[model samples]
Target: MGFTQADYEKFRILRVTHVAKRFDELIADESNDALLPEQLFLTAADDALAERAANRIERAVKAAGFPIPGASIAEVDYRDGRNLNPVAIGRIAATDWAMTVRNLLLISPTGGGKTYLACAIGMAACHNGHQVAYMRMDQLARRLTIARGDVIAHQKLLSDLAGVDLLIVDDFLTVAIDSEAASDLFSILADREHRAATIIASQTGPAQWAIDLPDKVAGDSIVNRIANNGRAIQIGGVDMRQVRSHEVADAL
Candidate 1:
């Protein structure tokens, strides 16, 4: 029997368009004529499943909001003096760190590729079917400050941040923050504690965070929650931005 328009419509209604398309393609292929019924059915099912999985990963990567969308772990440069360990990074990428709610702290100098590494790990999490969010510390502070003007929006924003599988905050403690922003940061970290993972990319370590935050107690709490519970990776190397520019100049 041949697949008809009715069959196509039914598959579309069921949201299995990939299956229908695969089945249609197989049916139109003369080479598939000798295949058994079970073989044909299984082939279509496999194709549909693979396509769906790919689509899901694509959606997750898009929703992650990575500044360097194309950044990937496999593409990382592990040159000397970077202080990056391939084995450690590979283990982190292969493990369920996000699912287990393990935080990560990336400390590096300006243009040291902290953002790229964070985004790469975030992409890995997304590939593992985890929801991820990326935002700079300043952006997060501004967001919280603006959201506070609307009560409902403020709560919703907090809830959303607290629920993600992984939250990557870049440029952490780069600038001093007000008491209100510090309070909001504490609240978010408190809510996410033991619930979700976080990645903090900062120029300096947690020791300096308290000085930059107006609320000492909240700052300490925030630092304790992140630093004590998470693993830290300190990157030391020449500024990658400069390296890349020099390479480009040489090429030109």
Candidate 2:
């Protein structure tokens, strides 16, 4: 009635390594002798599913390209001066808004952890089985501009960006956008509108975005879609980079 060598070989052939490992452990442990056949099978199946889900999340997180890959919403600092609302953060972390195709705007001063917060939200989305993409506005503009040289590459890039479940744009509107880049950005945003979620992390709000872009109409349209469709989280705190530096120096 016990699993034979042939059974183990069959598990290996089916690539159910987690199930195979679990079965090996259960068989090697005398404490599991009293477990019913159904119980043992269910436990091994649970282990296999859990391992596969964890691996899928890991792969999605890696593909997200988060600058701060390890950031977690649960670890956010809630110090008195930070002005972070635990309730709002919890809502964001739940990722229901993202599933509904809503957007988020993270407004903070330089070094106020906007990127970290964005990454944390992205990590949450990934955990919820959503695909995520992170890109700095300047870098995205450059990529789109380069892709424009090739029609196929240009369309493919837009398609890829539009297809992601969540797209995080960091340092948004930090630099002046030329007409061509503005047009490309508008196209990407338009494609994603009402279909996918986007997170804009910026030191400045949407008010200044229009003035910074060469094309007035495209700039206005972009700002309207992002600002109007998204909820804003304003982070007020001392510069986190400086705070960390002081901590390191004190330790030294």
Candidate 3:
């Protein structure tokens, strides 16, 4: 059977996923027109600037070595962040530590692509030559607990977090924050302020974060401080898991 238009459309969309070339190339009108629907690719390819942002998000992710494939600025949801309204769809291209001191908050349920967007931005910052790091809340907590094996080890872990240009904590708020962990997080955020940017991807939004955390009073204070420094992007839509599974099952 020949591939139908629907098939081709799906294929093309899938092909572009996480594929970042020259951000300009996605929309460039060149002799390459014969290869594709230049019209569509032109509109939706990738949106990035020529220079890299000096955010260490990717460095953090890399050092931690989470299994993320690649990152891109395009993966972010414009309408979801603390801003409430969508910035020009591709306007995130202009966001960087230098340009706006504002931070990013990605709040959503599982499989909502929050991590993808965070990693993409981190990757972009890395491409621009900024240091980056990624740590899940659980992982950070685990590292802290383990570091207790040596007094120096605990300080080193905190130092690693404090020095980065960008940081992403995925699955943040998964557990209630104990005083030890809460104090550590507060210190990290406080240390990174203005000098570095951090992205938090949490199942709980700022409102619920206080409740999810074990130290409600301290957690509330910490969240408020982070909010003071960043913007929250809440993603809402149908759950993508069942849909993707259905697609694969139907194909099989």
Per-model TM-score on C-alpha atoms: 0.94, 0.91, 0.66
Candidate number with greatest TM-score: 1
Q: List CA RMSD, all candidates.
A: 1.6, 2.2, 12.9
Evaluated with lDDT, which candidate comes out highest? 1
TM-score attained by model 2: 0.91
lDDT of candidate 3 at residue 247, scale 0 to 100:
79
Error of 3 at 228 (Å): 1.3
Q: Which stretches of candidate 1 lie over 4 Å from their true place?
A: none
By summed lDDT, the worst window of 10 consecutive residues in model 2 runs over: 93-102
Model 2 ranges with Cα > 4 A deviation: 1-17
- Winner on TM-score between 1 and 3 is 1
Model 1 lDDT, residue 173, Cα: 84
TM-score of 1: 0.94
Give the per-residue lDDT digits (tens) of candidate 2, residues 57-92. Answer: 999999999988899999888777677998889788
Q: How big is the positional error of residue 135 in model 1, measured in Å on the Cα after superposition?
A: 0.5
